[model samples]
Target: MSYSRRKFIQQSSRGVAGIGLLGTSALGVSLGAGSGHTEIEPGAFNFGVASGDPRQDRVIIWSHFQPAGQHSTPVQWQVALDEGMMDVVAEGIFVTTEARGNTIKVDVSGLLPGTTYFYQFRVEQAFSEVGRTRTAPEGDIDLARFAVISCSSYAHGYFNVYRILSERDDLDGVLHLGDYIYEYGQDEYDERSLRNERTLTPTHELISLTDYRRRYALYRLDADLQAVHRQHPFITVWDDHEFANDAFQDGAENHNEGEGEWRDRKAAARQAYFEWMPIRENRAGGISRTLRYGDLLELIMLDTRIEGRVAQPGGVDRQSEAQDFNRTLMGFEQEAWLQQQLSGTTARWKVIGQQVMMAQRYYIKLPDLFGGGASLWLDSWDGYAATRDRLLGHIRDHGIDNVVVLTGDVHSSFAADLSDNPYDANNYDRNSGIGSLAVEFVTPSITSPGFPPVLAETGAATIMAASPHIKYAELRQHGFILLTLNRDEARADWFYVADVLKRSTQYRLACSFLTRDKENRLVSV
Candidate 1:
């Protein structure tokens, strides 16, 4: 258990089971995922179910079984508040061995509290596909709703924005700001990778841990990303194509010296992303945490790619500052634990799920032939300009108003309004106040690929006609970003899906914005 790619429970690859078995109150785990339990067999529960980091009570259900016998496969679980599996609150049994490869995570706890549940898993006569999770607000909650999404590249097409966010039943969770899966190989996307008939299975690139668990079981056999993890609950984080592209805590730009080691391919992509993400591990912080939701919101997730990114900053001197107060994205101990959870939050929204683009991205101009000052993307946060000026100078020195920042890895879509001034394009009236403290929405790309439809609407009309706190930008879209928050406002709509390379694609709503709870600004509604 000495490995720690910024913790999320890799426990040196698994067989953990003993957080007192999710103790202190785990009250559910029984609804029927076992047709042969204690010795299961039949089709072992195909790769199609998940639940995630939620807590007011608990949540973390996941699966992947496959064992006709090499021993250990018991499986059996259930947690229901009714999806017609009768109210069965919780029941358990877990085995799926091979030192944790057959996968299965349970962690369900004493439910109740802004509740909503329904889980399933089995092994003998097959079951799975139940999901639907909730459970975060704890006391006198106001509102929280989410749905935010990010780079999803399975051979560059058709996830139909996870089937229109799995026909939303009004989400209360789902953040996922990372290239959820994409280590790149197979036809490496030319003919849209031969028009996805569910392709990509170690058809090349991943670099072992059995090629990132057979490319995460070919992207969990996408049935619209297993119906958005069977509808709801996902709060994830892992930008840098989940461990490669601009990766940094030591090296990446697609690793070199023949990739035989980049710390064992970033510890096999952090042990297959904590054995298939449901994220809940902090073994002394670094996955960078925080979550509260009740009196409005708090989230705060960040690891800034590899927990202390360092190699970006050099796309032809993107912002020169050599040693600019010692570059870092969230290094200095996660920037002093994100300025102590944004100056000890009181929760009326303070989100910050983290990945990139914390607005201040400059460098427009190609009209009249050339010249656009630096900043285009030295892997964003405008290449760590003193950690975006000490996190917008600690949210303008702790006067921290509503503060949002939910970004994603640039698959194009933005809304800005976090400032420290600078891109003044002749004072385009960003309310002359000089530096609004915070507001950023970002999200777009569950089907990755940005800027082609007329250079993403002409590079988003030259960065909103030269970034005066960029009100909004789309530059070719894919989808995801519902986001509501209450106790006086914090909207964000943006949907999209005109075609993820066609699977009857359709989703719409291309815009909406708002920001008033504490008002740092940004209003397009």
Candidate 2:
């Protein structure tokens, strides 16, 4: 058979098999980490184990195996109630092959709601590290907490933020907004010091299946990234950097003719992402889905960058004309699906976990020599104002309450109130937040560089002075946001790591903001 034909068959087979592989049997519900398991050999399961997309009764567990042998190998997996794996509630045998990059992703089901479980993989006499994961709670959950993070570029700096988050015991899961990986070459986007300190394997831009796979493998080698994946289940969505810089549907700003066909590169990136991440295999084959935490929250993850976005026009100065072209950020189908989710969910909080910022972000006006008035960051929602209006308008028209948007991609933290017109004094009161429809919390990057201190401070002050709806902005930080939800309100606490150039656990809370159950605004805590 041809290579393409063989690849399709392999992918199809793996997809069908992995979609809903339940545990073979339930041994018991007790707890302990049995000492009887064989000692692990070096470099057996090199990538480690991870679990994600937690429902009330099911979650996806993942591992990659690369042992010297034949193309196919039989692996045994088990889930227990204790860290020791002595309980053995779920056990199964999954056959992995080189065809699927030697990666194993099993959607384990029949789990208890709102409970913690330990899991591990075994290949012959060797055992992988045991991972900890939790399922979402069932009816009437009073509280939920998740670590929101994004933009981890390997060449930028150390992943100390991931390590810090891994050490925390208060999280229910993780929300990775986007840019989980970058596609730039080692020297393309980093400084000389950074390139020498943390070198990429390929040393060139990723454009093929082999290239993308090797890049992911290199990142998985990080102890901090592996530690977080071992401890918490992550719900993830992709942004531009996952494929290439400023990626749209048909092509990317970073992709060129010399890099092969855009569709081929895109397919390569998508395949490798599925193979590595612990997210559940979508039968429909798209990265947009909704996860519910009983009546507390409904997390609607979106594919804003590539699902169906029309390529942005040439310059940022043409924003006024682009608005007339009727562009879409999340496309039509995704927009309809999101509308349905927002209108139907009875949960107290309707959390939209997406890539770019949704609130209006217009820069300060320049001098006449530089074409005068405020120019928008065309990549964000400011470029697709109509879609933002439609979505926020739907919430207002249908009387939907408690809508919170979690975003990343600007490498800065922000708290803003979503409004129909923040600039119009009649529509919204900056101090009172009268006409606000929803709220947004943007998380800083894990390691990607943000603006310098002076520029960040001045830019933030200018934006806030003109746009009162923006409550907070901290641009020169590399950390994650701890988002806590409850019956009364939703609070987001921003924490900044002490240093990203070196691996350190030192971090401090920069600030915090919260919105009451019925109010669609942010209040400083």
Candidate 3:
């Protein structure tokens, strides 16, 4: 992949200049009464623009501007086919208001597929840095490539992985499985030295729209994060931390009665997410939508948090009727939509953008003194066993081939084969194969404790020995995955950064996985 930073800058400057001057009334509206500062600081452009929800001929563009004051203003946005500004493709006017924290989103459409375009925003005559984005390929496309990223926590460490990813020009876009922002309070879980020690915006818990906005602003300020947004389009889905820890359909692990109601917190999180993210309004359902890359791939981005999820329990066995087969990660409507899309689509591969592990994990027998029981994360698919089984059943019943589940939120890496029937003890036997439903690749955290010696010393080893479906697992590393998809196969190279505690961009390929010819079987590469 090749990228030209200079080209990006030159095009962005031109787009900014073309927007012309901002009207005084608009300026007054944006800066509020008595604030004379109209020109924004150079650093104000630090949080770059991003594009997402790509289609064959359209894509959504996003950016947030912190004007001088608490007012509203109209911003001009332009999309061009070339970085040279020779052919202006799509241009529009959007209003940024205090209601939406000065954030602007535009859904630009009507262009050729599988093409690159440059975009920029002009607020009050001030131009933002240019960004490059691409649309998905049209029908009958031969290939598509994307980078899969997950678990980026600011306090844990630097986003050097994001920086390197931003420089890659070969990818069509990026798939972020979630945990884009952590909700930990200041000094709670700092991975590196507490240099920029600051509490999350709300200062308390984020249970309101204002709180969510503040949190997003803090995350957007990260240099590497901004760079990645500027460099390529991203298809994102939120995991637990975006709202509160272990968020379910109705409540969250971080929420309490006195703090606020779960509904209010969830609403605030969703609102802030929509306002700040480069996601398209759920045209079909909600955040979960399908993006097609010709007939080669269909990326089904799922909303596991906000939909029909059951309440998360403190322990694995705490059962409730809500956690039954009727309960769902995606509501009934979404489940039906997904099934319809999958059944009707002609795409060679079905890639699900999921938030947690889908593969089943069980305990290995051990002495009582050695902690015989397994530790099932109540927040993951393991908690929704029936739902997982149903989805796998659908894959098998429909003969859906080449289903790949891209997941995050465990703070660990895993490569596994999804089985139609997990209860089958002889799943590996060729005669009793149980039919492969899918293949899943789980990415580790950007900076979180993974399989630390303490965890290992406890009983993880025994659990690992019992779980055969999990072909490979790695804990205690922070990085991203580079995925390249060609006609015949899809390959992922796990890139690991040396250290997130210090500012270092060093990375190496830790491992690789490949699935070939719609087999849905992951082979070590």
Candidate 4:
């Protein structure tokens, strides 16, 4: 059963009395004496509350407020130690206006490291659902667990995976590896949109600012998505669908000449994303940043979709064209930044959170009149061969140990070893984990479709058989990955849901793999 916010408020209201002052100190006073706002109202906080981008002392909390006939409104927010708004630790007032889509976000600072906090918002007599969040730890720590997820299309299916993850109490945070929301119109992406009772709000492709805002509001209205946001803090980075299909730095594949200017659409998409998401924005509008969790792990989030991607090469010679040194996926600036982060970090584990698979994947073809050979998937790292070579070669040369790559966007799950040349038998051993620079785990999509069942299973086998370094692949399931990091090893457990078409919590652990400390190869656990 889904745990609605209404039930949570009603259960916690017994200890509260009424509203308090605007800037309340850490006095541990109970708020909301007679507010009686147990349920959601039409014009106030209808999209729900969320928190993200956690650090040792701060985290960003967000919500949307739009009261009728008003262009702007002042909102009160409070953070406490308990579910009941009694043990107040921090409180403030922020103004939300029509220009920013009426979204409210406050970066609550002066927080204790590794502490869990419960927060609430208020406007006049209206109260929002209570939210729970945690700050990142400092110094040494033993273990940390995170849920890696991406690609949630509203028209595809119900958000059962989000609901299931929300029910869990052990996760430190959720790593959203992009595609938080899609830009497609009604019936554009999924044929079962009507059948699933899930429909897009704007009913057309997202081009303007309002269209993107409405699309985000539609996705956030789901009780499960709200529940997950209410339960745990999120660390997110956007992918192609967040803007459009196959989006690069300047334009996108789904974008056409009829849809006005690409720069305008891109700006609108970025504005709406910043307004809806709880991430901290930089002056240059770059989403690539580093997140550290004590001495245990340092998560380097990369923007592989829109920040600095060249248009992918096309036609039969695309593979050869991609080998050009000028072509880049993360741009030159981000690549330099990533190199500094990798070589300078002192954390036990270096984890990369980004979109797209990093391993080299190729499909073999039988010899024919045209002299058949393997074809590379240009959309992924295979398109930027030299770029990938530089990154992996750095790890191999610098001896960066326990480097793990967590990826999404393929709508499938895969476990593969990152090697300079997996096909070279003299250097790399398929059985003993030799000559491997790192390992990558590609997470499955939440609702986006994959190949048919027969093809998914058989094709996975074929790919693994051909690509000896790829140890595991599951294309038929839809779910997330639980990544646990400690001193000994970093383990990833693949969890799959029973169905996405219906609201169900039934799920199973499909497989498990781990790479020991100082060892780059994957071992089934």
Candidate 5:
């Protein structure tokens, strides 16, 4: 958690003055005649820097600055094509204020596409460490790859997976598909079963903006997470846990009648999320945006939480109505935008980056079971069957080749082929046939319970037998996925962390999946 003295100077305003190494004394540097030699101590501002929403020519840069005595101050940012700072490409000033938790976000633009740039920030007389970022490629690009990650819970285990992922130099970008931070208070969830679990810093549930910001700050303190953010540009989307558990359009399952108004809580969560995370404001138009990697790939990042979720149900039977095709995760406007993007895209692959799984999953009928049939978690695509079907239909109708759905929130790894009908048990063709659409790869949680005791005890055979579209499923384990995209095929490597209870970094390849040209089917890798 210690930053270098040189890094601090580079990020300070003094370094902006182009001062050479002065005589080293008690203070790091000696100021000239009228200049003060006082140095700003590191750790004054803790939240690390991040970049996101990468486009062909632009990407957003972000940092949260906390001045020693003042609430916050304006920090100047400079982006140079070279490490020597001889080729200054873009520069801007971002004011960090308490209103936004001293967070600053700058959307730097007008740079050459598919190029790497070095950037730094200056506050008063101190400058920050130089960070590197890359812009997306222009039209008809040759190659692209990204790491797909999600569901990193502090209370559940260590972040060794992040540490390993951070060291990988092959990724062009990182796609975080939600559940980046958990809302649970300390000791609320049991982690004794985990291997390398660590308790959260605050030891309390975050409900306010400051609490959430602090949580993010703590998370960024992890060396691995910081390295990963520093290593590649990130593209993110939020799932329910970012706001509250099982958050619908109007309210959440965790919100109560007396726990303030739902709108206020939702707004607070959204405000905190924007303040801490690297995302554009949730404007009225939509949170869906397209990132084109030249002609190679088009990543469509969607907002599935706020737009069209229905109110919480009164009972189990009432939940059945939640599946009304009209009850959407993405409102009509966003859905239309997605459909249009899919239809109009000329990229080799159309990647849907969002929360929740798209595959149709159902419970198997077991004779003399304790509770008969299993309940489908109403929060997933299972509860929005009609909308899921519609999306698949759109992909099929548009003949979108290499359409892949990257999802999270289930806290389990799932590889499936998107089919028109996955529930027709007697339809052998439906079971074995690869649908007209593409594939889906679900990354497991950084640390979340999966498969539970009962399901794990059953050996996952029943679940696999029930859902044929689900080609693969692993109820246990925690890790991230590395996706390599080529002109002819897309490959996903499931990196499973050995333990989440302690701080170990051991991992193994749980599985791999690949999709090739002409054949939208996903073959086991």
Candidate 6:
């Protein structure tokens, strides 16, 4: 029942039109008399191929075709085990039209668990890029690995992060912790006014569905992003940028009456998000769902920006009303669902793939004698202190062990421990009835603003000096986190590119951390 990678490739090449024929150099084309590269027709899949929301024995395959002006057309898709695309395991035909943007999304099922499958779409004589995707493993499993990334602004230099990530063949998939595409338009932010040719599109902030669609169009045009999508599935969640900066359920900081109503804008952004990304619809509360990876890891993907988040609490509210403990970021329904899942789950590691930092960060500006302490950010969980305290209290009360929070939206890498005493980060010594309840790993931005000047302009030493819980902080890096989880331990390796300005650059592993099972601690590797 077990198949080695060698055996899989061997079986795949047994016949012509094999997996290798799908267009990659390694799998050169063996189809008839055409060149190894057969350019697709204009009215075909010009944006490449992708798959996501992979479950055991099931996965979602997505492709977009331009009918030019046609109303409806039939597109065919197939799953093959061989490089030649011969040995067809499953095949189907789907209908597409301008109404759905000539896009096709198919949920293919009846496949084997923990199995790799290659798929492609045929629009008449042309073929969409062959996509490689694997289903999630079921029951007990030995190991799983994935790349965690976030905050990719088209105007902020190149997505060399995608290029580097696509080179990886061992990863199970990708976990995007939001900011997949920013809402800011051309020349919106002074920091985003880079010299990159791939500037934000529409020349304006996305407030309409059409605007959001065109924005996604420009982002998908990047060959690096396309290559990554064709290579592996992406499990994603949205952050504030998808809608607007500092977004809550009611409104956003960027939206104004002059632009449009906040509710309509939020709806447009949400619709575009689900339409462009290869994501499945959640039961309720939108985009908040849990994924079980065998028995080793359970990824609890949380939607912290929208759904039912309250407006951020300001300093006045914090001092005047005690910050209102009832104000929530995850809402009530989602919190209850998460509690139920974590309290009873059997997975060895429960990971929250969420947007924004959850760990407590303090501000310690020298008095006005130096320069007034800079304003602190309240958009993160720090703004909802009481809600965070409630969640941590629940974990401690229930004895939830091996909990790990993977965060984004800050554009920096951090390894921190969540203390049992939420009030004291430095006093988590396990003697004063205070100890670490969980650990968190924050992945840096892919191509967002490089902090104030460059990643973590304040320096890691300065940041850690304020928030002592963080064991390591790489503030000046634009990269992603590579995570490997097994039965006994989980390791996170940070990889950063040499330069985002260049189309191609040298990317190297910056550092690694090891978290022993149930230890709730990070050790530099």
Candidate 2 Cα errors over 4 Å, as ranges = 1-43, 190-196, 315-317, 364-374
CA RMSD for every model? 19.9, 9.7, 6.4, 7.8, 8.1, 7.6
lDDT of 5 by residue, 1-525 (tens): 221222223433212111111211211122121223223234243445678887777888877665654454778887787765556777878887667766778988787888988777778775565667888888666678888889888667667777777777777888999888887766665455544445454456766555565566557656567667766788888788777888878877777766678777677777777877777664663457888888878899988777676653347564455456677767777778889998898888888998888776667423323322233655676666567768878877767788888998888888988776655554324444545367899988877767666666465566677777777888777888888888898888898887776667788887899988657778887
Number of the top candidate by TM-score? 4
Report the lDDT tens digits of candidate 4 across residue range 1-525.
122223123322112111111111110112112223232233556667899999999999998775654467898888888888677778889998877877899999899999999988887767788899999999999999999999998888888889999999999999999999999987888563335646566667988887787678667767789889999999999999889998998888899989999989999899989999999989999899998999999999999888789988787767566666788998988988988899999998999999988887767533333423245677788777678888988887888888999999999999999997786777789999798899999999998888788999898998898888999998868899999988999999999999988889999999999999989889999
Index of the highest-lDDT prediction: 4
Please provide TM-scores, in order, for all candidate models, with all chains considered together.
0.36, 0.89, 0.86, 0.90, 0.86, 0.87
lDDT of 1: 0.72
- What ranges in model 4 sit over 4 Å off? 1-40, 190-197, 364-376
Model 6: lDDT to the true structure? 0.76
**Which regions of candidate 3 deviate over 4 angstroms?**
1-46, 189-203, 283-285, 313-323, 364-375, 430-434, 453-463
- In angstroms, how far off is 218's CA in candidate 1? 22
Worst 10 residues of 1 by lDDT: 18-27
Question: 1-525 in candidate 6: lDDT tens per residue?
Answer: 222232111221011111111221211222112322333234556667789988898888988775645578799888877645666688889997666656788988888888888988886765676789989999989899999999998877888899888888898899999999989867676453465645445667888877777667667767788879988899999999889988999999888879888988898888778777888875553998888888998989998899878987665444222135688887888888888889988999998999988777657433334432232556887677666778888998998988889999988899887873433535575232237788889999888765555536567777777765677787657989999999988889898888887887588898888778878777778
Candidate 3, residue 456: lDDT: 48
lDDT of 5 at 445: 85
Q: Compared with the true structure, what per-residue lDDT tens digits does model 2 show for residues 19-108?
A: 111111110111011312122222267666789999999989998766555457788887778887766777788888766777889898
lDDT of each: 0.72, 0.81, 0.71, 0.83, 0.70, 0.76
Cα displacement (angstroms), candidate 2, residue 216, comes to 0.7
Q: Count the clashes in each prediction.
A: 11, 1, 0, 4, 25, 9
lDDT of 5: 0.70
Query: Can you rank all candidates by lDDT, best first?
Result: 4, 2, 6, 1, 3, 5
Q: What residue runs in model 5 are displaced by over 4 Å at the alpha carbon?
A: 1-43, 84-86, 190-197, 312-314, 364-375, 425-432, 452-454, 457-459
lDDT of 5 at 318: 40
Worst 10 residues of 5 by lDDT: 18-27
TM-score of 1: 0.36
